[model samples]
Target: MTRMTRLTKWLLLMAAITLEVSATLSLRAALNHPALYVVVAIGYIGAFTALSFVLRAGMGVGVAYGIWSACGVALIAVLASFVFGDALTARMVMGIALVIVGVLCIELGSQAAHTRQTREGEATP
Candidate 1:
């Protein structure tokens, strides 16, 4: 893929993550002000739509989903602590760190697999 195309896909994935995080936060807020449910609906719908585009942009499903979910989880947890006064305990932080590490493994593994496939294909013919 061209550099621009790859950049566009990454940007769309980022948008998906942002929208998912916003919707989750909106869901929390809607508990107090029911009208915020509208935002929740729109955010989730938009997030999924953008995620579909990310998949269509030639990104592998496993890598895309892993990054999207990992980012959404990390962002929501940090934002909730600041926006809602939710406790961000040390244990939670550790869990978040582990999640990040897991995502990194997924991404690196994907790259290695792709490289191996390319090399095998080149050697075949």
Candidate 2:
């Protein structure tokens, strides 16, 4: 994909993360107030729509899903701690850190594979 396309895919992925997080928070609210279910549904639908665009833009499913889920989990956890007064224990923090690291590893691995393919193509006369 062109540089612009790649950039756009990444942006869409970010939007997906935001929408997913919003959906999760709305879910929490909906538990106490059923009227919030509409908001929750809208958030989830928007998130998946943006995620499909990211995948359609030539981003591998694994990498796209990894980033989307990792960021979504981390952000929701942090937001929960602040907004809902959820516990923020050391173990929870450590788990979040691990998830972030794992996603980074996947992303780096994908980039390395792409670079190798580009080099191989260049060397093919």
Point to the candidate with the largest lDDT.
2
Please provide, for model 2 over 33-121, each residue's C-alpha lDDT reduced to its tens digit, 9 standing for 90 to 100: 99989989999999999999999998999999999999999999999999999999999999999998999999999999999999999
- Model 1, 1-125: lDDT tens per residue? 68999899989999999999999999999999999999999999999999999999988999999999998998899999999999999999999999999999998999899889889999996
What lDDT score is found at residue 107 in candidate 2? 98
What's model 2's TM-score? 0.95
Tell me the TM-score of each prediction against the true structure: 0.94, 0.95
| Residue pairs that clash (backbone atoms under 3 angstroms), model 2 | none
State the local distance difference test value for candidate 1.
0.94
User: What is candidate 1's CA lDDT for residue 30?
Assistant: 100
- Predicted structure with the largest TM-score when compared to the true one: 2
lDDT of each: 0.94, 0.95
lDDT of 1 at 121: 91
